[model samples]
Target: MPFKRPLLSSHTTDDSESQSDSSHGGPSKRRRVSSPRNIEKDKTVLVYILQAKIDPEMMSELAMLVENYKVERGNESLEGPTSVSELNLELTGDVEKADVIVTATNMRQRLERHVEWRIAKTKAIVTPLWLQDSVKSGRPVPYGSYIAVHHLEDETSRSHDTVQDASSGSPSNMPSEAEKQSCWQTEPTELIDTTEVELLSHTAKYSCLRPSPLVCPNQSLVKEIDVIRQGRNVEGEERSMLSYSRAISVIKAYPHVITKHNIRDLHELPFLGVKILSMIEEFLKTGQITEAQRMLADPRFQSLSAFITIHGIGPHTARRLYDLGLRTLEELERYYEVKPGVSDEETMPLLDAEASANTEAAGEQSIKIGLALRHDLGQTIPRDEVEEINGTIMRELGHIQKGCKSVIAGGYRRGKPQSNDVDIVITHTDWNLGSQKVKGLCRKLVQRLHEQGLVTHVMHLSGFHEHNVLRTHHWDSLEKALTVFVSRHNSSRQNVYRRVDLIFTAPEVFWTAVVGWTGSTMFERDLRLWAKQQKGMKFDSSGISRRHDSKLYHPRTERDVFKVLGLVYIHPTLRNADA
Candidate 1:
C-alpha cells in the first residue's frame, strides 16, 4: 500500500521547545550532539510532486491512496502498522528539501529540459500508470531506473546497493545501448543552481505536443520565421516551408528569449538545422533576413497570398490565378466573370461547360447566393458575437436533441480572440451505432436546424445530394454541412450572417474528430508530420492506425491519443499558431 504522511505543518511545537532548551542550558550542553543511531532514526526522505501536467482527479486519487496506505517489503503482508522508518512518505512543495521528485511518463518529453537539472538536485523517476498500478497491486513499481521510487526509506536505508542491484523483471537492469550513448552524469546536488534551470520540461520533441501560449519568449522570432515560411509556401516549396515551420515551433516552445549564446546552444534543439540556424543568426545579427525581405517585395508572392484568401481557393488555384496576373480579391472576381473556366490536369477541363450547366440548372439566383455566402465567410466575427452565436447554437441544439454535444473547433478552440467563422462538431449520445447511420443522422440534424430558421443558408452539404441522404463511400467519408447562420445582436439591433460548419462524427472517431477539428492548422500539420515521420504511424480525422498493418488504434480519450502517439497532451487553449 502507498505510505501516508502527517498533515501537520512543517514547523512543529518540539522544534520551538528545542531552541528554548538550548537558550537556557548555557554553553557546555548548549550544543546538543546526536548519536549515529539517533541521527539515522531522525533521517527522512522528502518528496515533491510535479503536478503541472498531471490530471487533478488522478492526482487527488493518488494522494488519497497514499494517505490511506503503507508500503511493505517482499513477503511482508500488509496487516498492521509499519515502523516510521520502514516507509515514511512526506510530500513537500519545496524543491530544495525534496530527496526524490515524482513525475509521469506521459510528461517525460515536456520534462526533458529539466531532466539534467532535476537529476542534479534530486532523483527523478518515471512511474507508468502510477495511480492505477499502485492502487491495484498495493505497491509502487518504478518504470525506469533514473526515476523509480521502488523501495521505501527503510529498505532503501538498510543497504542501498542491494536495492539498486536487484532485478525486478523490468525491460532491463542497465540502460539500453541506445540510452547509454546519450546518458550523462550530473554534478552534486549541493552545487546545482535551481534558479538557472527551467522546471517544466516539454513532453515531446515537437512543440505541438506541449501547450505554447501566445506569450512565449520566442514569439517575435517565430513570427519572423513564419514570414519566411509563408513565402516558401507561396512559392510551392512545401519541404523547405515545413522545415522552417518546425524550427519556428521549437523556438516558440523555448522558455526564454534567444540570444547569440543561447541560439548557438540550440544545436541539439529539434529542427534547428544548419540552414535554419544560419537564417536565424542572420536575422538576429541584422534584425531581418534579406531573402525574407526580398520575398515580401516580390509581386508573385504578394499576389499568391492574397488569392488564396478567397473561399474554396487552394495553393494550386492561387498559383494559377497569379500566373494570369490576378493580384487581388477584386481582380479575381473580375476574372471569374470574364472566363468562368479554370482548370488543371486534375481539375475539370470542361470547367466552362460545367459552370454553364450549373448556372442553367440552378439559375442565376442560386449562383448569386453562393457568391454572397462565400463573401460572408471571409469576414471576421468579434469574440463577443462569436460567443452569442455559440449560445444560440447550444439553445437550438438542446431542443433538437436532449443529449446532443457540440464542440466549437477551429481558431476559437485555440483561444483566438476572434474567428473568421465558427466551425462546430456536433454529435449525439444515442447515435453510437456506427458510420453507416452517420450520414442520415447528420442530415436529420441539419434539416431540423434549417427548419428552425437558425441556419439561414447552406453553402455546402456533404453526405446528402439531390435531397437524398445515401449511404455510400463518399457519404461515409465524413458527414459535414457548411451553412450561414443568422446571429442577432440586440444591442446593435441587427441580424448578421456568419458562416458556421457542422461536422458530424460517429462514436468511434468522436474524440479523434474533436482533436483534429480543434486545431491551429500548424498544430495539426506538425502532429501528423511527427506521427508519420517519427513514429511510423498514420493519423487523421478518421482515426489513428499503423502505417503498414492498417490496424486501427482506438483511444478512449484525447489524452490517450497523445499517449499512443508518444506526445504530450497539449491543451486546446495553447494550440494557437497565431499566438
Candidate 2:
C-alpha cells in the first residue's frame, strides 16, 4: 500500500459534512476551511527520506509513525488505512521524483554529487528536532518549520523590504500634495545599476589584467581542467598543456557562474578554442568530461603522473620512465639501482643510470644538486615556518651588512598555505655605488650563513654577467645562489633542510626583481607578453625599457612598475593565476 507522512495541525475540524441547503433547493453548500487533512489531500506530494546521522531504531520508529498516523475530526473518524494513499512516500533512491526530501546538513554534499540542484526538483528540508518530538508524542502536534526553508524565506523578505523602501515610497507615510509637487519640480537624478555587472568587461580579455585568487566561482571546474592539463604535461604534450592553460586562465578570471547558457558563446571568450569548448559543452550536458575521465583512468597517465611527483623528474623524464615500464617509485628505485644510503656525490651516478640521462654537463650538474636535495625539495614549508625562516635570514643579513634588506617572494608571497621553497630578493643601500658587479657579495653572504650553521649545502651559484647594453632581451644576468638551509620549528635536535633562493640585485632594479619573482609563473609570463605586444616595450627581472630606446625605466616600487606598463596594480594574494 502507498504511504503518507503524518499531518500535524494546530486545530482540528468536524469530520461530519457541514452542508446547508440552498434556497433554490438544487444543491448543498460546502464551506471550505484550511485543515491539515485537507492540505494533505489537496496535493499528493512524493517525499524521500535520507538517514544521514539518524540511527536505525529511530528511523524505523519514524517510518512507523509516518505510516500509521490518525487524522481525526470531532465526530466521524478519518483515520483509516486508505488515508495513507494521499501521499506517495518513496523509499527508493530516485530523488528526482520526490517533491520534498528530509535530510540532515551532513548529507547535503553527498546528495549534491549525485543530483544537481537544477535537475533534481526535490526541495530539501533539514530534519528539525521538533519533528522527532512530535512523532514520539504520536498526536496532531504542530512542530517548528524547517530551519533551512525558514531562514531562506526570512532573508528574502528582509531583502524585499530593503529594496522596496529604497526604490518605492513607503505606504504608511505618504508625501503631502505640496511635498509631491516639490519633488516633481526638483531635477531628477539618474541611478545607474552598477552592481549587476560584477566583472569588468574591458579587463576580462586577459587573465593577467584581472585579479584572481585561490578561491572563485568556477573552482571545481577549474580543478578538473587543471587535472587534465597535468596529465597532458606528463605525456610531454606541451602544446596541449598550453591550450589547457589558456582555458584555465580564462576560467579563473571569470567572475560569473559557469553554466551552459553563459558558455554558449565560447568562441567570443579569449583563449577558449574549439577543443576546450567541446569539453566544456560535454561537461555542461553531462556531469563529466569524457576526455578527462578517460585520461584519469588510463594506466599510462597514472604512471606518468606518479613519476612526475618526484623531486627532480620532469615531464620528459617521466615519459621516458613510462616507456621503460617503470610505474611506481619502488620500480624506479630498483631500475636506477638506488641504494638505501646514497650519498651526495653518488647522486649524479644514480641520476645518470635513469632512462633519460642528462646530456649537457651543466644540466647534469643541476640535476645532481636537485638529486642531492630530493627529500628536502619534496617537503612542504608551512606559512609560519616560511615567516620564521624569513625573520632569521633578515636578522643574519642585517648583522653581515649594515643596510641589506630582503623581501620574501614566490608562492608564499602569493598567499599559499604552503610552498615548495622560499625565494628572497636581496638589495643593499650601497648597491648603486658606481659598479657593474657587487664583487663576490653572494660568496660573502654564503660564508656568513655557513658560519652561523644555517646553510646546509650550496647547490648552485651564478655570478653577475653584464648584458650587452644594445640588445633586446627577456631575462637578466643577475647574481644568485641556490642553497639548502637547516630549519627547525621547535627545540627538536633533528633539522629539516629546505630550499632557499637568494637573488642579489642592484638597488636600481630591486623593485623590478620583486615584481618579477613575486609571481604565479603564468602571471609573470602574461605580463611580459603584454608589455612587448601591447606597449612595444621590453620587460624582465632587470628592468623595463622601450625597444627603440636605450634608457631603462626604473620603477621604485611594484605599483610604479604596473603604472609604467599601464596596468592596474594587482596585490600579491591575487596573483595566483592557476586559481
True-structure RMSD, every candidate: 15.2, 23.7
lDDT by residue (1-579, candidate 1, tens digit) is 223433224454235335534754622221122422212222233445566455666566556554455333212433333522222344555555554455653233445554444452334343324333433443233323233322222222232232222312222233322222112111011211222123224435655665566557777667777878988887788999877876776776676777887776688777788888888898789888778788789888888887666545657767877888778766765665422222111112112122234423332232334334445555688777777776777677666555555667787766678788888776544433444445455556656666786765554555522211332332233567666677775457455667778787664556677788887777888788888998898777666777766566655445556767876556676676443
Model 1 CA lDDT for position 46: 45
Clashes of each: 8, 0
Measured by lDDT, the strongest candidate is: 2
Query: For residues 193-303, what per-residue lDDT tens digits would candidate 2 score against the true structure?
Result: 132123234236555686677676878788878889988788778888877887787877677777977786556778888888887778778867777788889988888
TM-score of 1: 0.57
Q: Model 2 misses residue 124 by how many Å?
A: 58
Off by over 4 Å in 2: 1-203, 265-267, 285-287, 334-343, 346-362, 365-375, 434-439, 472-477, 490-493
Instruction: Give the candidate number with the greatest TM-score.
Output: 2
**Candidate lDDT values, in order:** 0.55, 0.59
Query: Candidate 1, 305: how far from true, in Å?
Result: 1.2
Off by over 4 Å in 1: 1-204, 337-376, 431-439, 464-477, 490-493, 530-536, 547-549, 577-579
TM-score of each: 0.57, 0.59
